[model samples]
Target: MRTRAAFGRVGYMAGALALSLGLLGGCSAPSVSTQTGGPAVAPAQDRDALEAQIAEVTQALRALGPGVDPDEAARAARIAVLKPLDWAREWQVVDAPLVHNVKVVNGFREKGVCQDWADAMEIALHAEGFRTLDIHRAIANARNIKLEHATVIVTADGQPWDSGLILDPWRIGQGRLYTARVGEDDRYSWESREAVRAWTREWKARALAQQG
Candidate 1:
């Protein structure tokens, strides 16, 4: 009895429901891989490239302020660049990030979502307990449920979150890392995670009052 138009509407609604469920399960917007293949042990050339990046990041961290310790900068740079790559292999990330996230949510895999990477990175950096640096958690597109993303940011001690550098591993997928200033990243507008949580709580409270 249903017309073709009704069938199209049903299909659209089903697709939207899948997307909403995926996002609610801690996945973010789909991401394109910067590299073509899955995670692998860095070959000689890749190791050289990674070392070069570590040095570059170290230099940037040291430039944050005179109070930033050189030793801490080097250590943080190494961990920030290396841990995600290790996790990629551990998570068996053989597909694009969103694909991997679906597998994870469906019980085919364990963890490799954007939030997983962010949480692991934050925990590893926080464990270092650096005296001259601060590790922060941030969310982008927090007001948009479907497009939300989370990341780790690093700043000089006492500097605000926006002044930090974003270390995002999920954006590029396949274990490749992406780094940019919180203000300079072209893809997302960053907000402190704590602020977003507080705002969400207030919004939920208002909704509950309206229903009463």
Candidate 2:
């Protein structure tokens, strides 16, 4: 497991969605802003730059093999999505979801959350024309409330049962993101919640420390 510090490298919260959206102007981290859910337009220059990066990553993915390599494509797609999101997060341009503690489903009127990460991933990947994976939102350890964790799931070639990957960038810090087979990685299990309580306790403690 990654150190708690790795998860809270950047601790400040974002402001209103409009203001936070403005942080996208230069792709720098700034305090995030929250508002009724809406898509914020990124600056043209930043968007263009991201587009170029996606194109580059796509080219590299192509070199993997003739047919679409779902794993490779998924990896590349995660990177493509994370790069910009990291920029936004680093600059505080991205809003994080509100968490009162590890147990409550606090209101989202404050900032971004798990849903934000998933939303950003889906939006950016689609914008990049990444078609290798279908995005799905899932809960880890559905049976346990305290350990229930939300994550973004990707199905290879839009097929959930065929091949799947988990694009969980929020698992670590220092602009880190995690990608793994849906049920293969020991990080979390899709079928049955495993170690979710421990993981949540660890992460929540780390988060609280950061806030302190």
Candidate 3:
């Protein structure tokens, strides 16, 4: 009794619903980081591994500068590594990032895309209000809509953006955090988020003028 278009809409909704239910049933919550003052939610083996990573990240942040506060470094490292994992679990990210992007686009998931990861990380770190550390937002492949990527960078306060450390969780997927110095990252040439936004605005204006 339904038209073909009506039947297609119904089928799409049903598919999305099924995917959401499957994700909920399959993904388990990740353990909270010890530095966050919460009991571990993971098994003993996984908990040990996560703790080791937190320590490593802490060391990396401290090495950024002699003036970097030890306490601030430890806190930043803990949030950088653990927050994304928590988000991944909540978003039920069971596939690679791009694959999960499809899920989000189709309404099978709420949020797990690269931009979402970057935005979440930046917000969490900024909340710490570190006096010895600075947070930056960056974009890669800004001219290519299909390949554009966003990430959060952390640097010693008063240091240049290029000298900072990159905190990216969406690259490897499943909430596995990746960190590297800005100069060491060979995959993408990063640009300041503000610069990219200004360029985008100018580009749109040019396009509109040409069409007029």
Candidate 4:
């Protein structure tokens, strides 16, 4: 009986080993190790491609901006000055407003806060390489309301300066240029806002220097 029991135990041990092997085989595949030290990450090629695309788009946008219109591009040299500057963020010293106050709301400039808008325009013109002319004539439609109205006539060609006041910003549109040049009696008029026109050397020496 003891010998029979030993044989039975051996058979049982063999069966147990076979079952263990079968169970391990049923597991089928090995799991990829994702523990403390896993596989190396693939380089982020897609991320770099996206960044490169963004840079190209930005360059395209900047290239589109400096386009010239001959008439319009002429003001590129000075538009930076009259542009609505962020006084609060950049130039706290001057305190220019983000929005300009011209005609509608009785702007600080219109109400005589930093020189009548005309004088301010003249100063800007002078600074922007422009000169001015004061019209004391009895022209039918032109007027100054209070003072002898002065306007910046465009004389780039040195023609006989026929009060064709070429205020520059108006050049942005031919309509604006047309209207600013022809005022009340079909004569030309523009409030001396930031000048679009400039003065020649001859006029600069005479009009502005002799004023004050």
- Give me the candidate number with maximum TM-score: 1
RMSD of each: 6.7, 14.2, 8.3, 33.6
The order by descending TM-score is: 1, 3, 2, 4
The residue pairs found clashing in candidate 3 are none
lDDT of 3 by residue, 97-125 (tens): 55566568787789987889999999999
What do the candidate models score in CA lDDT, each in turn? 0.81, 0.46, 0.78, 0.29
Off by over 4 Å in 4: 1-73, 76-115, 130-150, 166-179, 182-212
Identify the runs in model 1 with alpha carbons over 4 angstroms from their true place.
Answer: 1-37
Candidate 3 accuracy as TM-score: 0.78
Task: Give lDDT tens digits, candidate 4, residues 1-212.
Answer: 56988998657655654443343221111221112221122136644643453344333222223431233223422231232121111212121111111111222223321123333344544555422222111121123232223333333232334433333221111111111232331323343332322323546777778996
Q: Give the residue spans of candidate 3 off by over 4 A.
A: 1-43
Q: Candidates' TM-scores? A: 0.83, 0.44, 0.78, 0.26
TM-score of candidate 1 versus the correct structure, residues matched by position: 0.83
Per residue, candidate 2 scores C-alpha lDDT tens digits across 92-207 of 42323222111112232332344455566666666655465455666555444334445666554546431455665444322234555665666454542234455668888999
Please write out the lDDT profile of model 1 over residues 1-212, one tens digit for every residue: 99999998667655654674455533343454323365444666788899999998898888778899999999999998888888988988876666666567666678888889999999999999999999999998778755578999999999999998888888777667788888898778888999999999999999999999
Provide the clash count, candidate 4: 6
User: Candidate 1 at 164: error in angstroms?
Assistant: 0.2
Q: For model 3, give the 10-residue run with minimal summed lDDT.
A: 25-34
